[model samples]
Target: MKRMSLASLAVAGGILAAQAAAETAAADDIFACYKTAPAAEPDWTAIARDYGHKRLKQGCGQQWPVAATPHPQRASAAAAALAVKTTPRPAPVSDFIWFVRKDFADVDMFGKPQSNEKATGAELSWARNNTAADTIWQVNGLVGLAYSYLNEDYSRFIGASLASYVKVDKEAHSAAASDDSRDAITVGGSAEVGFINPIGGADYVRGSWLETRDGILNRTTGQAKLEWMPMYLRVNRQIPGTFVTTNFRPDLKVQYDERQGGVVPIGFSGFGRSLRIGPEATFLFRVADFGTTLPAWAEPLAGLSGAVTYHWWREVYSGQSGSWLDSTIKYDINPNVALAFSYQKGRNEETAKRTDLYKLSLNFKTCAAFAGFSGGRCTADKD
Candidate 1:
């Protein structure tokens, strides 16, 4: 028993001496917890790897708590976990992009029972936007043909047009307390030029360049409009947990019209160009995200507008003023597909005469690549 006690004493002295020497050498540099449990050590390299900093080494050769290259081999379970997580988070990127949307419309009219007054058309809209911001530019083109029998005469009408719109968004801040509501003010302008052969009365009054006779007689028209949204607000719908949103905006528009036609009955008959200006007050209500709250969520929207137009010409039809009304509805089937319908009634160049037009349209393959739109691929690019 005495011999065993002396042996234990010598072992204890050797351990104590070794520990004291090691501590004296590593007193200021090493972690005390790691000295006791080196196998379960934690540091910045390990932490950074947890969030996907793969190329970083385990020890950057700095002082304690050093941020450096990640050496996954030193970690027990960390290395195994990282080996399984091969995919890396995408870096944020932002830039300008181009988009195309396909659309079809069946257009007809009220107060005209003839099938010639009804037609279906397809249109394509191309768009370009600054994905880093809320501004966009879009151009639309459409072509359609119509044939109908009237007075034993078969007349065919064909038309084509190109229209462009540009929007500059000055306010892009969301006002929702939940950090997702969208509130914006957009200022924009639109211009369209069109040509048609052997048109009807409705097409003629709508400022299309077309003659009423049978063969391919040509008529041309050009128009421009300004769009402004002074204020807008959006909120959760009546339900608390749904992704549906209700929004309201006050919209303003000013339009100018020029049509190539014959001379007026009274004064200034020197030219074939006619001019008119109209200012409108409009409002919009929109609800979106019925299925998912993803970006570019399909939305259903509606709008109404009223305006007083002033038309100027030489004699009989000069200094004419009248009221105009327009309404529209849109329903998106998915992020990439949708349908739209609109009705409009406006004053004519003839005294107190009015013309009404109806249109139904289908839209597909829609893409608006920006952070603000659904289905958009935008990454934050920091310089």
Candidate 2:
């Protein structure tokens, strides 16, 4: 009985060992299949069918333990990224501007004026974006027309000008409140052609005129000018308990003007170069929010502002020297209309003589009051 029991036990143990070996071999086959699989989505069902492996077919039916399924959020985000890459952006708008200004002098319209200096005038200008390469600088082009009714000599002047300007540098700002805004350096050149007609067609009236003025015989005149602004500073301060704002801008301008004649020294007979260096400063105070807390009667003063400007220039020409001092005070009723009073004591550019004048005028502009007239953005200066 003991011998028979031992034989049965040996047979049972052998069968168990065989089953273990078979399971290990199936696991090895599954691992080998995974190693040869493609990187992209692999068809495991087709791979198992081709290999004719029963273990691989059973493994394919179950979830993969080594490979993870992509998250839905990640897949959606990738799709959005692709869409953005394929989209197109809009283009920028072009600028085309037109501006007009008219100045009416305070004169007795019913009677003849005491002097021709007090006259009405109009100026028209057109500016467009320049296509010059602006990799480092900004460029602009402008054309202007001006008409003056009468000057001191009872003459009318009609002029046309073409100018080009370049902004070589950008404004820089400091962190401190005192040194806030610094304007860019600008350089410009202009060419002007003018026609001067004398009301009294006499040789004596023309003989007393300056060299720069055109006589009746020589009705056509030309001038070329170059301007440079190296320094411009602006400061703004707010009033304590009101909606008032104060602004100050101090600037310097250096300019050279060349007329039709050639260069001639002061003591010498002929013509010479003309140049002027000037410094101008402006101070302005305005109620920024007039309509907010004020009554209806004060609505007209909402955009009201006042400015005072002082100009001092030294002229150097033909070895001769002269200086000019001028001051002007302007009050704006609104954006478009203004009243100005000016006291000028200087060597007059038109008459080329020393003169003192007090003038009052009304100024009108189209760009600020009717923006749509320009068909584009309204800027203080063309750019």
Candidate 3:
């Protein structure tokens, strides 16, 4: 963590830039006209233009070190030297941002799928890359509230998380998940190593692990994943650089109850353990760009993603195998709002924990992203 400097505090208070400009003005008041060359060939118009200098005195007042090049252009030697001393740049837009989102799904919200689930989420985040020390880092804090009712199976969960990501080196997307706070109240973190390429889109195998416990569940769980994008595969003739990403994820879900350890279909017991391993493959292609327009209730399908994962499960309650073929179509409704449709087919214990469900859900998002990653169309960078 970097300590807060006085200049930073002034900047936060919206006074640093004004103060610097005042200082520069004071310095320019002392410019020497005697050392300046006449207003002949070496006019020094570029320096005066950029520095808001309309008169020769402003250019002469430039607080730059005089160069020893005893040549014809002595008029702008000081200006030339001072140009290297650039004024502090304005902070990037929304180094810290706050956003709110609401989602409605026909099926369960990752819980049970028969009933509709209504959820709302909010987040405050900050990301800085190529910092004063030329470093990459991101921090985010978010909370989500969800509710669903299925024949007295009324469920309500508030999941809050805080995490920080930092780049360890200058490799492509080499940032690591340095700190993690999982599911409201987990006093732990995760470590990950990854590498990515602009053209290949992260083709290296990277591993990561995290363990978390919260008061809502009163239990602990550990999750790990190793992801790799082998290469691109042409799904159709026109699609370019279609990526094929593969990964394996392992999960350990355990709870404790006084009664005999046996798993039920719907929920977890006090002292029960379930272990699952999942292998997944996904194909994705970017079909469109930003500012895409769509009709009423229709979204511009910007990117296409389809994934299949098979889960092998072993538990005290039931030992079985389940799988899901999920497909998601991303759409850019506008710069502020985006819509998506996702379908999943799985009865894995690690997921819905119900019988197989033919589920489809639509997500609406209104957001602005200031930093690096390009997750959706509602981005501030416009790149």
TM-score of 3: 0.32
Q: Point out the worst 10-residue segment of candidate 2 by lDDT.
A: 200-209
Candidate 3 residue pairs in backbone clash: 108-113, 255-270, 255-271, 256-270, 256-271, 257-270, 257-271
Instruction: Return the number of clashes found in candidate 1.
Output: 17
Per-residue lDDT over 90-195 for candidate 3, one digit per residue giving the tens place of the 0 to 100 score: 3321122122332111111111111101111111222244433222221212222212111111011111122222111011122444222123222222222223
Q: lDDT (0-100) at residue 110 of candidate 2? A: 9
Model 1 quality (TM-score):
0.30
Q: Model 3 off-target regions past 4 Å? A: 1-190, 195-237, 240-271, 289-319, 348-352, 358-362, 366-383
With candidate 1 superimposed using the best TM-score fit, by how many Å does residue 116's alpha carbon deviate from the native? 32
Ranking by lDDT: 2, 3, 1
Counting only residues 3 or more apart in sequence or on different chains, how many pairs clash (N, Cα, C under 3 Å) in candidate 3? 7
- Give per-residue CA lDDT, model 2, range 199-263, as digits (tens): 21111010011123223122222333332221123466778976667766565545454444333
When 1 and 2 are scored with lDDT, the better candidate is: 2
Better of 1 and 3 by lDDT: 3
- Lowest summed lDDT across 10 adjacent residues in model 3 is found at 108-117
Residue 380 in candidate 1, Cα distance off native in Å: 16
Pick the lDDT winner.
2
Model 2: per-residue Cα lDDT at residue 124: 19
- Name the regions of candidate 1 deviating beyond 4 angstroms: 1-217, 224-229, 232-244, 260-278, 289-317, 347-361, 368-383
